[model samples]
Target: MTSPTGEPARTRGPEGPDAPANPLTRLPLDELRRRTSMKWRTYPPDVLPLWVAEMDVPVPPPVARAITDALALGDTGYPAGTVYAEALDAFARERWDWDGVVAERTAIVPDVMLGIVEVLKLVTDPGATVVVNSPVYPPFYAFVEHMDRKVAEAPLDPYGRIDFAALEITFQEAAAGGRRAAYLLCSPHNPTGTVHSRAELAAVAQLADEYGIRVVADEIHAPLVLRGARFVPYLSVPGAESGFSLMSASKAWNLAGLKAALAVAGPGAAADLARMPEEVSHGPSHLGVIAHTAGLREGGAWLDALLAGLDENRTLLADLLADELPQVRHIAPQATYLAWLDCRDLGLGDDPAARFLDRGRVALNSGTAFGTGGAGHVRINLATSPEVIKEAVRRMAASLG
Candidate 1:
């Protein structure tokens, strides 16, 4: 059987350097539907899901081999040792040219978001304010509030970047009540995919120091930066010694289901991380550490190939939008595979995702959940086949008629 795009659905074998330029799109839609990931199972069979952050690609061969070898030897006990942390340190130095990440100062956690929540608890008190950039990942709102904390949003600038002036105002407000606050910064931000420059990060570090607001950066998308953009580790900035950053290979290698992440503390913030309870360390899966480590240490070639494919896909998306949905404005992301489309001109109401799902049978993340400027927008996942992306836009355009 064929998918909505008229492409035949086929399951893929393992991926290697020899795989297609975009190995992600090689999997057939019918085979993809058989998987149990949220990206596949969250919607009805007819709905083309392009919402969640999960990539449709198979794991790199090295990552896959690491996991399989462990399972063969029944090595699925509790995680042990500093291999994961060491691998990350090596990857960071090689990939981003940042040597600030000390393996001794890092700890493994179940995932990046959980690490953020745990780190926030260390920096802020109950009911204290937590600052975030609006039009951000939805979980930033949910997780912070789950801690009984108040969330303050500093909306992004029109160019989809951190609004330094607005951020300073928010930081000042967050610190006004003599309450300790935390800034949840999304580097290479979600939805918009704007990679922050060094100057921008420096400004943030200055503001955080001025207001005494603890900075917890979610750098999960660090490795997925496309061509022409750079991913800088927040800790690499001069005055960011007190910042805490959460890193993971999950997003880069499509290993979210395995669940392992690292929380790195800047030189000044090591004590804060040391205060994190011992029990939290037990959440990371044993196999997850192995898988993620393999991806970091041995999967570099696979990652390079994926980036090239994603680069092509991004360019293709710009062309498709221009030809098929000219009314929709997209910035053609510089980092992540997510494309933030401004659909306000289409006159869709506050919740365009709902209309798209109901009318077009394409599932996209609702922009309303992103807060503030999010209304009349939708976040589309660009990690799938070019054909699927073209088909999704075609369906969306047909829905408008």
Candidate 2:
């Protein structure tokens, strides 16, 4: 796993000069000129902002062209977006081989968060217990409370992995006298970046079926799986063919601001989708429908390249960590551009992230923000340039030197 510079850069995977790769990782030379000349009056110039999980790459060429083409027609209002809807259905079908009643099952929402809130309300009762794996996405907690339901925190075990043993006990305990109504399932779980295997999903489906619980799988991270891993859609699992799956191009393709997502329902999934708030979606932005369709349908090449770049960046971050700071344990992320670090040994006493940031001048997504299990960890996003990642690690080494 060592690079020519004696750093841990090359991770094990398919190797070759023509190895599948993304061309966007390389920052243009003109960036040097701009960096040399530019100055931001609002924030400090020295800040390496990797905390927000935004990619620095330009919008994929095809997506940009599609937007431009749409604008040329002066078609920008909420007049029947029939063509766009059709394109999205075809795109979803082709991309994931997910077949369903496209028009009936699918509806455009401004964001995935909105779709989730709607679904949570539909599945749970007032003061109902919604099971969640902590050290999870912040919004999972927010969405539960936002819908007037109580969140039952199921803390994942050490190494920041899911504790299925505890999960079973928790579910059983919740439904001791009656049925456990719902479970917020994060397939290709966020924060921890654990993409559940088919076997795991089957077990989950069995338990949910046993308890008569509704599972809402947030599958936004499915498309971002790295080289050696495969992302399995929860609803598509053999046992979960009757569950709900929430999907978006935002996580992988940087389409969040576009405001679009597809809420795929199972055979009996209509009740959940139908119960969603009516006013929440006037329908997604005109451009969101267009860009999402173009990206999903015509974006195969762009996606492949983007994944390659993410893989390379993942390697670079691991190497830097191995050489620059050995006490911080880490695992080769099965998927996603995120690198999870075990900073438990840092022994910073108070807030480890705060100390690391103060000393290294590197802003990381605080571990505590991900819930209890993330106490001594930080999620490092490698979805940016190698130079930027290296610099952040360099700063970390110096700060803790």
Candidate 3:
């Protein structure tokens, strides 16, 4: 199949070999605007929305079929068994070559954020401190505060990598007075798209162990690691045996609305994970489990195609910024579809996203909300067609005039 621009499309449905080439190109702008999702409904029809992490791609054929089959059978009820965990285990084993996700040691939760909250409860108290690397997903602050936990920032280095010295200082401060602490690690980090290396994860595990801090990794973006990068499961790290990890196909498969995730426990952390309330398992919907399971179990080919498209979009965006918005610094991401843009040199003040939305009619995520070091930046969702990316850049450049 070919796209509107006559380029070979890179998408495919469950329609065997006849599927299209690009998932991002499957849905056109008019069709997208008709949907009522947050990405589409958040802005007026004239504004091009690219703020949220939601991708502008069609549902994977296997995922759609699974949901359809379940609905046809009237299989809407509470989720049961360990099918989701088992599927994740298989995917991880094949993709990351790690088998730390033992079904017996995993629990199903509503989503990655909820799963994280539950895991944090198991290893931390209401008032305990949770350390985070700044300029991260904003929810890390909102959710942690909502759970009545204090937050300590361990800002990432200037290059967007983990700063060991800053982390150690934050750990010391958080663990002072013999207080229990937890480090919320964002593997294959959001916005920046910096995939943590195995050695880097090992270093993190080492720090957590020395500070007597428990680690809970949010590996939701693991499957979206584009190219030239690797995602290491936290539990697979040696010193992380006492740590926890929350993962889901939600981000990769655009299943956020389906709402199903797993909280995996390392060998040494099994007992603490076991203490989670039984009611927590009741949070996931039966249909969600079915869809996520199908995606993880049978959506491998679809995921690879999506990754290929995203890789292209990242490179396209870098080239666009260089030619049109040269003042905007874009560090091409190593993973995921989100692009972190440094607009500090654009002379648009802290929240350049506002200018882009107001003048350019393009909505991007304001970095200010992403916490410290987020000012003078905006996050652009690159999970769309190349045309949209090009247009967004054009609009951004026009906004400056």
Best-matching candidate per TM-score: 3
Sorted by TM-score, highest first, which candidate order results?
3, 1, 2
Candidate scoring better on lDDT of 1 and 3: 3
What's the count of clashing pairs in each model shown? 1, 2, 7
Clashes of 2: 2
| Deviation in Å, model 1, residue 114 alpha carbon | 0.6
lDDT for each residue of candidate 2 in 140-238, tens digit (9 for 90 to 100):
888778777877777877655567887787787656668446778876777767767766777788888777777888877877776666665677666
Of the candidates numbered 1 and 2, which has the greater TM-score value?
1
Ordering by lDDT: 3, 1, 2
Clash pairs, model 3 backbone:
9-21, 9-22, 10-21, 10-22, 11-20, 11-21, 11-22
RMSD of 3: 5.2
Question: Judged by lDDT against the true structure, how good is candidate 2?
Answer: 0.71
Candidate 2 residue pairs in backbone clash: 8-319, 135-370
TM-score of 2: 0.87
- Candidate 1: the clashing residue pairs are 10-28
Model 3, TM vs. native? 0.95
The model with the greater TM-score, 2 or 3, is 3
**Every model: Cα RMSD to truth:** 6.6, 5.4, 5.2
